[model samples]
Target chain A: LAKTTQPISMDSYEGQEVNITCSHNNIATNDYITWYQQFPSQGPRFIIQGYKTKVTNEVASLFIPADRKSSTLSLPRVSLSDTAVYYCLVGGLSSGSARQLTFGSGTQLTVLP
Target chain B: SAVISQKPSRDICQRGTSLTIQCQVDSQVTMMFWYRQQPGQSLTLIATANQGSEATYESGFVIDKFPISRPNLTFSTLTVSNMSPEDSSIYLCSVYGTGLNTEAFFGQGTRLTVV
Candidate 1:
């Protein structure tokens, strides 16, 4: 399993674009980057997943450089409701069974007005 | 995504007692896993429950302390044995159901407060 490192916390104003970067320098070729958002008292929700280059979803966009050493999750026009902890996970979608994920201490994002 | 429900969403238990948390999925799943989350902390994998076989526990967790059962594909249970203050945490169960691009779904969680 690959280890991930993220900032302890970050603050941003509402309506501004916020980007949270995660570093997984030792990522393997088969490893994929996934981001999850979690709110208080609730389970974490799947945000977006990517392998290389860029991947966009309805909620956010993931930017990965060619080196794949790090990835960034970009949230456009943040709101107070967007305040939550963001986790970066590196793993591959298994071919036959469930791929276990290890959730490390994630970056706590606070969206301020 | 599958809809999951757990029993006793929150409970307060006495020391040395045991509490069993139940997990139910709307559809049959291939894999089920249990996780423990301390307050303001990241999640820790407890074990993986498979039907008709014993659960595989992670390091620092034992089957005797956190016994698990998977009677079938749609349901599973986790028991917190000999509860103490250290066992006070949120226990969540997740399932990976059948599909091409499936993701794991988690129950609301069981908040166990042992005193």
Candidate 2:
């Protein structure tokens, strides 16, 4: 598992597009980039994941560069309901039964009305 | 995705008492995880629970303080011992889906407040 770095906080108005970047300079070949969102007093919810290139899901889109050293989570048309902390996790796909997650400080996305 | 049901959504406990939190999944899962999140803090994994095997504890967490049990594929328990104000936090259980790289799901979380 490699360490990840993300912005401490971000602010965006409702209906805006927000992009949060995560840097994992030491990422390994087996490592995959995953994103999770968490609200106060609740467990984190998986948003999206990508190994390379781009992967989009219902909630968010994940973009990985060719080097795979860093990735970005793009949240389109943000809303007040999307205000929460976003986490970027770097871990191997074959880590076995337990995909034990290591969380960084995370990027706090505040969606203003 | 797996659905996890955690018992005792929230509890207020005494300093010397213990509270056991139960995590039951709707379907069989190979691995179960326990995590703790303090107020306005990010989640920290406590241990990994596997059926028929002893839980694997993480750094800064010990068996006596946070004992875990996974009796079968679908159920696990985490006990917080000798509670204190510092132990007040949310405990969550998570499990990976059937395939590798599959999304992981979590319980709503158990809010524990020790006075």
Top DockQ model: 2
* TM-score for each of the candidates: 0.96, 0.96
lDDT of each: 0.88, 0.91
Q: Where does candidate 2 chain B have its weakest 10-residue lDDT segment? A: B96-105
Return the interface RMSD of the candidates, in order shown, one decimal each. Answer: 2.0, 2.0
Per-residue lDDT of A54-77 in model 1, one digit per residue for the tens? Answer: 999889999999999999999999
Question: Given candidate 1, what's the lDDT at residue A56?
Answer: 94
Tens digits of per-residue lDDT, candidate 2, A8-70, equal 999999999999999999998888899999988777899998899999988888999999999
Q: For model 1, what TM-score is found for chain B?
A: 0.95
Assess candidate 2 and give its TM-score to the true structure: 0.96
DockQ of each candidate, alpha-carbon based: 0.53, 0.62
List the lowest-lDDT window of 10 residues for candidate 1 chain A.
A91-100
